[model samples]
Target chain A: DTAVSQTPKYLVTQMGNDKSIKCEQNLGHDTMYWYKQDSKKFLKIMFSYNNKELIINETVPNRFSPKSPDKAHLNLHINSLELGDSAVYFCASSQQKTTTQETQYFGPGTRLLVL
Target chain B: DQQVKQNSPSLSVQEGRISILNCDYTNSMFDYFLWYKKYPAEGPTFLISISSIKDKNEDGRFTVFLNKSAKHLSLHIVPSQPGDSAVYFCAADDTGRRALTFGSGTRLQVQP
Candidate 1:
């Protein structure tokens, strides 16, 4: 069974289209994160949510937003998508309770193609 | 600026040999370091980790060495098998933020 899962394993869209990627974790984790892996294979964190609350927001553009309806789910919506935004998006989850040793679990990435 | 760096884009090793992957970081606040393995079209899976307080950690044939003073770390796999082939990413855990900063992954190919 997959502990973390993401929808739309592959997405092909044109520029200026708005799209959403949904993420869910069945590992009963309290923290969830969204990361983008660019063409260079560099992975960077975009946002983090703790118990359905926004905890960390990187220098990502405002057009990108993360919604956490609950601790088990975190969805990313991109508005006015650009060609530069075409990349693999990964969703991850971890259990954190003041411990510095928690490892993150990641979902199979969604490869978005901006045509 | 990139905080974490994995200079090598790829590495190749023969079976039953040693494979060493190196990573360097500029952020001194990172208290924990981890290695993740990723195959094509799949998400990364955690392989091993080392705390800043400790210099080394090992499990099975995989071992991670951390050098806080040098701000460098390396993952060593002895008797590398073809099954161990994958893209290896070096990540650092931001102490208070609880977020990980990952480096550009290095693809490791263990030839049979």
Candidate 2:
């Protein structure tokens, strides 16, 4: 079984369409994160959730929202997607530890393309 | 502004040789550094990591070196194999947060 999994490995939609990506982790981690990798291969953190609470929000657009229903699931919803939103989205999770020694496990990325 | 930077966008190395990938960061608060390897259509997998307290960490063919003073870190692979060709990303852990800052990835091509 996969430790972390994401739905819709590939998504193609119009620029104005709204889409959602689902993510789940079986690693029993308390911290979950969303990252976006652009065409330039630059990976940047979009948001982070710890124990169902929003912890870190980077300088992402307001059209992007992240929801964590429980510790095991985190979903990302993009409203009014734009051409600039086309990228590979990754979901990651890590255990809450005293030190930064905890390793983050990532799911297979979801490639989204906006026309 | 990007805190972590990977100046080299791509690298080439011959098989059975050594491959060195470099990364620099502007944030001194990052106490931990990690390297991840990613193949096409797949997520990045953790390769190796180094803590600020230690200068180096090695595992089998992979080694990570950290220079806290210079805010620089590097990943070294010995006896590089063709299978080792992949995109390598350097990440830093913000000391007080759970989020990781990643640098632009470096694609390594190990020629056989």
Candidate 3:
């Protein structure tokens, strides 16, 4: 069984269009996070949710919104996607809301291409 | 600016030999350090980790050494095999922070 899974492994879209990436974790974790790996191969955290509560909000633009309907699901919705948004997005989860002691499990990334 | 850094982007080693990956950090608030391995088109998988209180942690052929004084850490893999080839990431986190600061990454290739 997949501990964490992401839908639509590959996404190709046009600029100014909108897209959404969904993530689900079966590890029964209470914390979930979204990270983006840019062209430079830098993995940075964009948002984090703990038991459906927003916790970590990075300096990401307002166009990108993250919603967590339940503790097991976290979805990222990108509005007005730009060429610069072409990158790989990953979802992760941990047993606890904090990472000081637990390891975070990650899902297969979603490769997005904005044309 | 990136708080965590992996200066070496790639490394190659012969099978049955050892592979050492280095990482450095500039943040003092970080209390835990972790190593993650990622295959192509996949997310990173947790490999090993070390706490600031300890200087060394070993699990089988994989060992992680941390030097808090220099703000540096290294991962050593012994008798590396072809299956060990992958991109490794170094991550750090603070006590209360929910996110982990990651280094760019170091790709390791073990030739058989």
Please, what are the lDDT tens digits per residue for candidate 1 over residues B1-112?
9899999999999999999999999998999999999999999999999999999999999999999999999999998999999999999997688899999989999999
Q: Candidate 3: where is the Cα deviation over 4 Å?
A: A97-100
CA shift of A10, model 2, Å = 0.2
What is the C-alpha local distance difference test score of each model? 0.96, 0.93, 0.95
Count of clashes in candidate 1: 0
> How well does candidate 3 score on lDDT at residue A110?
97
lDDT of 3 by residue, B78-107 (tens): 979999999999999885886899999999
Q: By how many angstroms RMSD does model 2 differ from the true structure? A: 1.1
Docking class of 2: medium
TM-score between candidate 2 and the true structure = 0.97
- Worst lDDT window (10 residues) for model 3 chain B? B92-101
Predicted candidate 2 versus true structure: per-residue lDDT over B46-111, tens digit per residue: 888888899999999999999888889999999899999999999999668867889999999999
Docking quality of model 3: it rates as: high
Query: Between prediction 1 and prediction 2, which has the larger lDDT?
Result: 1
Tens digits of lDDT, candidate 2, A24-99: 9999999899999999888888999999999899988999999999999999999999999999999999998775
Per-model TM-score (chain A alone): 0.98, 0.97, 0.96
Instruction: Find the number of clashing residue pairs for candidate 3.
Output: 0
